[model samples]
Target chain A: MTINEIQDQIIEEFAQFGDWMERYEYLIDLGRSLGPFDERHKTPEYLIEGCQSKVWLYPSFEEGIITFTADSDALITRGIVALLVRVFSGRTPAEIVDARIYFIEKIGLRENLSPTRSNGLLAMMKQMRLYALAYKTKQEHS
Target chain B: MKLAKSIEEIRSDFPILSTKAYGKPLVYLDNGATTQKPLQVIKLLEELYRTTNANVHRGVHYLSDMVSERYEAARETVRAFINAGAREEIIFTAGTTASINAVAFSFGERYVREGDEIVISGMEHHANIVPWQMLCERKKAKLKVIPFSDAGVLDLEAYRSLLSERTRIVAVTHVSNVLGTINPVKEIVAEAHRHGIPVLIDGAQGIQHGMVDVTDFDCDFYVFSGHKVYGPNGIGVLYGKAEVLNELPPYQGGGDMVANVTFEKTTYNVLPFKFEAGTTNFTGAIGLAAALDYISLLGREAVTEREQALLARATTGLSAIEGLRIYGTAPQKVSLISFLPGAIHQYDAGMILDKMGIAVRTGTHCAQPLMGRYGITGNIRASIAFYNTEDEVDALVKGVRKVTEMFA
Candidate 1:
């Protein structure tokens, strides 16, 4: 699926929640159910330091498509990362780089996505895009 | 149990208390970061900007004279609030961080030499830690730390050993911003004085909790921010000993800091003016006076008692939560609690609480060394003021329990 389609799907899923508590509970569940990340990828190279939480994002490009995996200490942050990974992963570097993410706002998680929130979501988003841009540059060079 | 005024009256004074957050009544417990200003302080700031808007100390006009008089009077007000010797000792700066930097630069230039030592406590905020660290780096001096226990009590024995003839100065917090430990600052001051070392007490957390008599403590410097003490932001006090401050050179060379400036040489101003270089925060200073007056009318002793009760109530309520670990279990503490609910991340807990219209601080609280000591990234801090009530404490406790259950 395209990034926007997946984002719309996620928004639709979140719209089912009755309240902030329910939304958070679903997020926590998502966090708990995240696929096991490679332990070796958890290093300073992949670390994104947020004032409130720590996030680690690792990306791999293969056959013109990029896959992303990330983790955070905070459950809610982990859930948010899970959402980003879902939307951006399994897409071409060009597609990932050019995609505009509006799911966070639609899901009423805009507060958490603020740069000043320092939960690493905004930083993670920027880092993800940077990774895609680098890979795209490398692809162009080849 | 008698208060100067009822909690209802005190809450009414702060207009923000009635405000809502996320459709819920705002339960603000971030007083350690900064207190909500009373209507008097807010109104005074507005009035100053409206009518008394003029540059202090230099203007020859009527507005300037009026503002200058009020600004000087504010200095007197601050001097009396901390029970300092005279108004000359009280120098206003941007805030606590700026005040500490001024001391670090000026004091380090005069007293510190190569291979000297400066002492600070482990739990000091970055404001207290970084300035001294910079001073130490510049002078090629060593920075010694006084460690605290698991209970967050400062080890004075270690502090005593840390001081020596090579020790240029000792800087410590009167109260730990994160730990809420009210260190025995009087004893700390005495110990530093025994070795002829001047002490600077970071009173950012201390001055708001209770009465701070600088002469009684006999510390060479007492620094605090106006915003933290229910006053306006962008203004802070650096209360130095008149004799000690007289010896140190000015931190900055600007308009007000010098008596006369020539292309050849510049003669510096005396005492407080020497430290205050540029156009000072006169409006903030006046607003701070209003805040101090508000506190005075409320009565310091009364505020202390009321806060103590709130702290007790909060401590009791928070202690009951399963698997919640409260850091800084000091016997002597102010109305603040830093804790982690079970294994939950502080950010997650804080975010959830914030959604419930409860404001709290969830980070290192600018005490990374202390966080290092605790072996954690950060924790959630709910710091209370007198305006906070048992209902608010109960709400926090309920919120924590809810967070814990959901995480489970």
Candidate 2:
């Protein structure tokens, strides 16, 4: 599916829930499914800067597809980054970079998230895009 | 002394107390950051803009005279509130940060020299620490720190050893924002004075919880923000001793602060005005006076007692929570509580609590050095004011329990 199609699916899943509790539950469940991050990749170099909570995102490319894994100290922020990793991983550098992720706003996450958490989510996405950009440049040079 | 109104009555005077935060009534426990203004202060602010609006200290017109009088009258109110020696000692600035910056520059210019030392405590807010650090860096002087104990109280023996002939000034917080430890500032002042050094008390957190009489504290200077004590932002008070202030050079020179100006040289204005550069926040001054009036009418002793009861309840209730470590355990402390619950991170717990409509501050509380001293990144801080109630305390305890379970 396209990036928009995947985001639309997320919006539909969120629409089935009525209140904040259900949305949070869904996010926490998503975070739990992300499994344990490699202890070596949890260093300061992999950490996303400008985040209110501690978040680490590690990216690697294989067979022309970029894969990402992430973790956060805050439960809500962890869950939000987990969602980003789920949607962006296993995609080509161009696809990950060009894809527009509107699911956050469409699912009312933009308005519902606190100012601090919202900034963290945006920072997490920016870090992922940066990784994709680096891969895209590296492939062109080769 | 009789309170003009009860706790419920005072709570009613603050309209924000009635506002809901996520479909639940907002429980504001972040008084240490800033206070919610009462309706009296809010109405006074509106009345000033509506009825009396003009530039102060310059105009010959009626509106100017009216505002000028009110602005200076607000200075008098602040003087009376802190029991400052004279109105000339109270210099108004943007807020606590500006006030401290002014003192740091002026004092450094007059006293701090190469090899000079300025001592500050570990629990000082960044407002108190950064200014001295800048001053020290500029003057080639040294900034010395007085570390605190595990229980969050400063060691006076360490403070005494730190003070010496080369010490210029000793700056410390009257109350710790993160740990909620109320230091023995009076004793600290005396110790510094014995070494022929001066002291400045950061009263940003101290002014509201109890009486802050400068004469009794007897420090060389006392500073606090208006917003922390129910006033509007962009206004703060710097209460320096008259002789000490007269000696230090002016902070910023502009229209109001200058007495004479020439291309070659200029003469500065007298005390208070010498420090107040440019046009001041006249409306903010008036609003601050109204807030002081609100507290006065409520009666200080009565308000302190009521707040004490609420604090005691909260401390006891939260102590019952298993694995909840309350950071500051000083017996002399009051009102505020900062804690780390179990293995739960402060951010996750704060998020869960917010969904339930309970408001609390979670982070380093701007005392990062103190956090480092305690070997933690941050924790949750719930600071109370007199307007808060036992019911709200109960809600906080219950909310904390739920948040811990949710994260677990």
Candidate 3:
């Protein structure tokens, strides 16, 4: 599915919840179900900066596609990472670089993306885009 | 003063206490970040801007003269509030950060030298830490840290040992913003003074919680922000001994800070005016004085008593929760509580609590070194004011229980 399609699906899923508690519960569940992150990739080199909570995001480029694995100490932020990774991973560099994200606002998680919030979801998104851009640039050069 | 108002009446004074978040009544426990302003302060600000708006100490107009008098009166109010020796000692700056920066730069220029040492405690907020570090880097001085124990008590023995003949100045916080530990500032001051070294007490967290007398403490410098003490923002007080302040160079050079100015040379103004550069925050100073007046009417002792009760209740209730661990168990603490709810992440708990109409501060609370000591990145802090009630404390405890259950 396209990025917009996935975002629409997320918004629809969030719309089923009546209150913030219910929505956050779903996110927490999603956070708990994320794939295991490698311990070696938990170093400072893979750590996303500017977050009050620690988030380590590791990206790998292979066969013209880039895959991302991430983890956060905070469950809500981890849930956010889980969502982003699900949407962006297993996609080519060009797709990720060109993807437009609009679900966070629709799902009422726009605060996590605010510059004032120390959750670093915004930073994580930016880092993901930067990685995709770098891969795209390198591929074109080669 | 008048008989202290009941908590209900006092809560009424602050309009924000009535505010709701996410369709629930707000439980504001983030007083450490900044206290909510009372109608007394808010109305005073509005009244000043509406009727008495003027540039102080510069114009010959009626408004300017009136405002200048009120501004100086505000300084007198601050002096009386902190019980400083003289009104000339209160230098108004932007906030506590600015006040500390002013001292660091001016004091560094005047006193700090190559290979000199500046001692600070581990529990200091970033506002107190970074300024000295900048000063050290500029002067090639060394920054010495006094370590604290698991209970968040500063080791005065270590502090005494750290102070040497080459120690330039000792700076420490009167209260830890994150840990809520009230340091023994009087003894700390005496210890530094015994070594003939001056001490700078960061009173940003201390001033609001209890009475602070610079004369009684005998500290050379004490600093605080207005907004944290139920006053206006953009205004803070740096109370310095006249003898010590006079020896230091001015931090900034601008309009009101000079006695005489020429292209060739300019002499600085006297005492407080020498430190206050450019057009001062006259309006904010006036509002801060009004806030002080409001607190006086409420009665400081009563406020402290009520807040202590809230703190005790919170501690007891939160301690009862299984798997919950509270940090900063120093016997002497203020109303604030920082904790980790079992294996639940602080951000996760804070987010859940925020959605439940509880406003808590989550993160390092700008005391990274203290966090490092505890071996945790951050925790959830719920700092209370006198306006906060037992019901709010109960709500917070209940909220944390819910967070742990949800995560479980």
| Per-residue lDDT of candidate 1, residues B1-408 (tens digit) | 366778888899999999999899999999999999999999999899999998998989999999999999999999999999999999999989998999999999998999999999999999999989899889999999999999999998898888888999999999999989999999999998888889999999998999799999999999999999999999999999999999999878899899889999999999889999889989999999999989998899888888889899888888999889999999999989999998999999998999999999999999999999999999999999999988999999999999999898
Per-candidate DockQ values are 0.95, 0.56, 0.81
**Using Cα atoms with residue i matched to residue i, what is each candidate's TM-score against the true structure?**
0.99, 0.97, 0.98
Model 2 stretches astray by more than 4 angstroms: A111-119
Full candidate order by lDDT, most accurate first: 1, 3, 2
After TM-score superposition, what is the CA distance of residue B353 in candidate 3 from its true location, in Å? 0.2
Q: After superposition, how far is residue B47 of candidate 2 from its true place, in Å?
A: 1.3
Quantify how close model 3 is to the true structure by its C-alpha RMSD in Å.
Answer: 1.3
Every candidate's lDDT: 0.93, 0.87, 0.92
Q: What's the i-RMS of each model?
A: 0.5, 1.8, 1.0
User: What digit string (tens of lDDT, one per residue) describes model 2 on residues B279-363?
Assistant: 9998998899999988988888887888788899999999999889999998878699999888787877777778888888887
Q: Grade the docking of candidate 1.
A: high
lDDT of 2 at B280: 92
Candidate 3, which segments miss by more than 4 Å at Cα?
A: B1-3
The total of clashing pairs for model 1 equals 0
Pairwise lDDT winner, candidates 1 and 3:
1
Off by over 4 Å in 1: none
Chain B TM-scores per candidate, in order, are: 0.98, 0.98, 0.99
